[model samples]
Target: MMTDQPALPAPPSAEPADRLLADLIALRAAVLAEAGERLARLAPGGDAGAGIHNLANYLALRGHDLRPLQRRLMSRGLSSLGRLESRVLPTLDAVIEAAAALAGAPSPTAAPDPAAFFAGETRLAAEADRLLGEAPGHRRTRIMVTLPSEAAGDPGLVIDLARRGMDVARINCAHDGSIAWRAMAAHVRTASSLTGRRLTVLMDIAGPKIRTEAVATPDKKARIAAGDAIRFVAEGEPRPTADAPFSAVVSLPDLVTRLAVGDRVRYDDGKLEGVVESLAPGEAVVRVRRAKTGGVKLKSEKGLNLPDTALGLSPLTAKDENDLATVIECADMLGYSFVSRPEDLDLLEDALARRGATESRLGLVAKIERPEAVRNLPALIARASGRRPFGVMIARGDLAAEIGFERLAEMQEEILWICEAAGVPAVWATQVLEDLVKDGVPSRGEMTDAAMAARAECVMLNKGPEVGRAIELIDRLLSRMDGHVFKKTPTLRALASW
Candidate 1:
């Protein structure tokens, strides 16, 4: 004899669905409002305007914590919004409509048009083709190989590289003069003609990069270790004699005068890190805090990094202006090094204009190697892409030095995502397949790194003796990865092993 009982209204099965729908609707409104506000300020138009709007939507969506919402959506067999970098609004709308349907509510809006939803990817691909040259038929990622000095004299080398799938030839103005750069450009042109393919030349204008100028040490074998004090003096100033501890002069003397006590300094690509201990009329004393196991030999010409100091140095130097005369003549693209702000790009644009180089004639690639650039990336992209075909380079060596090595992976990923949102191509640079290029053998870690680089529109390889082999390997790797991943989204192609 059981008494009739209620089933507790079936546990209100629709409650979670209703809550999810409400959250989606709220998110859509917030994202739209933010994008509208940002676009209002930009007043962008044309293709660039479309990119700016998508970027704004992406930034707004990322501004919120979506982990909880994502989990709920996944549990309900709906899209979790994990891969919406390129088309933010469309993704949000689709999710909202699906949630509404499940909750027995009217759809929030009509389904998005497939073409409009996928326009971001299409624009990005076209921009990449315009800026970095079209990708090879087999692989979507283009290869940019830095031309060795010998490439100027060795036409065979340039032709061989082109045959090996080198899409762009990079000429580093920091190392070579105008004559060499012109020769390299000529060789690249010749190779393009011979191969019947387009070969773009990118000339990297050396910015005001600080480096050790003159090193003064007690003995030829002098080395620096943890707790050792070293003095940084202005170049051409009275150097410390052998009686004093190790000392070196920096390329920029004004930077030394501006360094305050407790400022962090890194040397030799961060092999030796130090802190400012004292300052004088023309010298700043630093105490080494970290170094290699035993010590690092004091050397001249090593890069000097001031991560903690705010360097008011201009990204363009007098030499850069001089080099632009030649760069504008032959190069299809300009790689602006150490670009920290939108104003830096303005300076480059002004220089290009002065040289009568229009945006259509020369594309610009802003090298992101500073913390400021990372923080101001969105603004940088807007300023650059609004003017011309633009790309961003993850100059990881200096970037890692500026923002600790631990953050390198995370920052690079963020940069790729942001560039994709803006429909701008990104060049994955700095030591891709370094060991393989240098030693003719790929490390397991570097193979993985090369695979990751497939996300970028272009992969740059520094000049090396074995670069041909590296190009072959990277080309194959990129083709394979194309079947597996695209940006942050997994392609989910059928597993061959399975």
Candidate 2:
């Protein structure tokens, strides 16, 4: 037993407390100054208004390095500013007031209004309901399934999907004609009525076709391997001789002409990658840099990705303009593919306006799949949401090919945060449960991916034979994950696993 030594003086709190208060005040001022114009431009009396203001505040706040400040705040049992994505200003004000109180100094700010503090979450929920329809009673995340061509002829299939919890039906304009799309839309409507659930039909417009037009191999059976040379030729260019290097024609001739030496090119969803070895008027020779051990087949119609190239091609094509006639009539939402800028949204808006599809009538979803889109996301969100109901789809297939696989995880999280900040619904798309849907066998990785997807407002599954099973499994997964997390916040519901 030791005699009680005089209690050590509490580690001097006054200096650290004062520093925290000052840092917070400075941070608040910086946010307001940087985002003043954007805040002022937001229209009042809507979900978008407060959410956008907070988004602007968050963008500015994240511009500074706050790690040191966070550590100091944590030492004093005050907020570390780590979970302030939705309510940026309110969190700062609360932390500042607490710091002042702890230091026995005059409170620099008054208490935050409770309503203002929670408005971001409320608005985000409202926006999700408006754009994606209300989530099911059991879960907050909605499920969107791409309709296969067979869906046009099978009413039972669509109805079963609805019964299994398909909240939204996606019709890809890249595949079928208007008649088939109308049939698919009609099936969705029938399914909705039969299942007694409100379902949304989203028609995705095919932006630009950057695909392989043809493939010419010496043996016709040899696959592309690492160190192999392949020439990318333009349409109408003469095919290389059998003895010449293996060659493939690109659908976009102009794009091929613009490729410079050393530019990276990915094929078939990045299964194979190469670098430009040389460039000519109508073709570029690429040396394969990475592939499977043996080799991989290069097929016509597979997608081609140029991550290092600046492709200024418009998202709209002649085919898309024609497809809009069906989209404007049948779709509850329009998916704008490859939308990389504010102007891309404007072009689509104008087109919709010409067709008498007002903002209230159709929801617009910007499919972000390019680096430029990631860079310009804030402007794109502001432009779209300021006009009408809006959402963002993380088109991961092309995005991973563009921004590298290593950055995909980080970028998707950032995207989710920004979308949450603006009260915009994000649809987690591409390869959600590919193995299970296509082969009736789920992988451990895909199962984990599906669980992680619950953080998004919606999860999109591509068409496959066993998609109904995929839908049911993801529905259960999302429901389970719902009690554990929301956006980046971890909910501490009592755990049963202990």
Candidate 3:
């Protein structure tokens, strides 16, 4: 059993490092105490409020970094830091006392009341809304739609989306050039003006995307079935055809060399699955495990997911740096992708500072797609929250692939809970009502998925021919579900009479 006693007090030390440590501890205590006072209003005995306070303190005592602790409390409970201090302040005091003794200073008592930390909860929420250009009295969640490439030059289409309920317009930086991005922003501005509604433009930085580069196939598509063997070769290597068909090359050659035998590989958004059967210096042989009757076609530029291997690559690529400049110039918000560590957020902040951008004013939506990002989410959001108007995007497609399909639902819920703990909004992204947007007909399953997405602070629709109708339908469903469910909170708003 763990003992309740504190470690024996350290011998008095006059060293400079000891003094610095004491100062840091004092500063941290002050911050915590201030937070405690602010959260005191939440009523420490209240069921929900007390749980948040306890978790907050629990994380603080463990000396976990600010972000990870915040995220843990968030994923595990509710309320932001201010409300979290009620339970954490006592442990915080004990920690401070121990540090003070170690530094040879008089042992300090409990922290001052938490009043200094009492910034209202609405303060941060309002800042997020402002960054996203959300108007007063609008719905709690916003609707964002990825702009079709053609929409850059079509002001009418942009305007139509705004009229139908597009609160934020997303421009994927990976696909188009600066000219196209500028045009899309201009069209969105025009539409906002014509419709007398403001729309925020969000540009996504495509970070180190690994994809199938090309395949040695005459028909430009390679079909594979369960039990088929395929060779993954590095570019310029001797392309060896399998007994069933041809080999495929991946965009990132290094990943090919790194694949280990038995590692699971998924293609085309997890539609095709393969196991690495053998490995070579610049190639791997894979045995297909999942495929349709028509067989899965391996196409150029489709995403490749290696769930079991550590991908050795920088999170930020040269392409991302070039895109950041344009995003800063033309977008209200920037979507950060492939982030795996707190240092990655630090890199982004450094870049923003170097570019003369107002870091705090620009909305930075962190895309949670990788396992590392999820594990480090609390710290990620903590770092992000310190630097800018922050939110999260549950980038479900790659996320589902990264963590495995079986755990996608649980992962999404944990992400949502963590975001709520941080008190920041989240955007439910990828393939929401995909059929409805692409084919102008909603599938029964997708319709249910859309309703589920209403729980998030925002729902994103990928650009498609029928996105306008998709937005209309989404708006109607969201309106119906508004008072019924919100982030696990049941609303008792009166139902409409038939």
**TM-score for each predicted model, relative to the true structure:** 0.94, 0.93, 0.76
Regions of model 3 farther than 4 Å from truth: 1-124, 135-138, 217-222, 242-244, 496-498
| lDDT of candidate 2 over 1-498, digit per residue (tens) | 787788543443446567767878888888889777555554333445667778888888888887667657767888548888888888888888888897779877776788887778888888888888888999999999999998899899899999999999999999979999999999999988888888999999999999998787767678889988888998775366543468888998877888889999999989899999887778888889998778988788999999889888989998999899999889988999989888898898888778787658688889999999999998788777757778999999999999989999999999999998888999999999999999999999999999989989999999999999999999999998999988777898899988
Note the residue pairs that clash in candidate 3.
37-114, 57-88, 67-378, 67-379, 68-379
- Residue-level lDDT of model 3, residues 120-165, one tens digit each, is 2344356557657773243566789999898877888888999999
Please tell me which predicted candidate would have the highest TM-score against the true structure. 1
lDDT (10s digit) by residue, model 1, range 1-498: 676885432222334678888988898999899877776555455344788889989988899998767767776888648888889888888888888888899987765889987889999999999998888888889999999999889999999999988999999999979988999999999999999999999999989969887787777887888988888997675376443488888889877998999999999888899999998888888989999887998887889889889989999999999999999898989999988888888888888889888657689999999999999899898887657778999999999988888999999999999999989999999989999899999899989999999999999999999999999889888999999998888889999896
State the TM-score for model 2: 0.93
| Clashing pairs in model 1, backbone N/Cα/C closer than 3 A | none
Error of 3 at 468 (Å): 0.6
- The TM-score that candidate 3 achieves is 0.76
- How many clashing pairs per prediction, in order? 0, 0, 5
lDDT of 2: 0.87
- Residue 63, candidate 2: Cα error in Å is 0.7
What's the true lDDT of residue 323 in model 3? 81
lDDT at residue 488 of model 2 (Cα atoms): 75
When 1 and 2 are scored with lDDT, the better candidate is 1
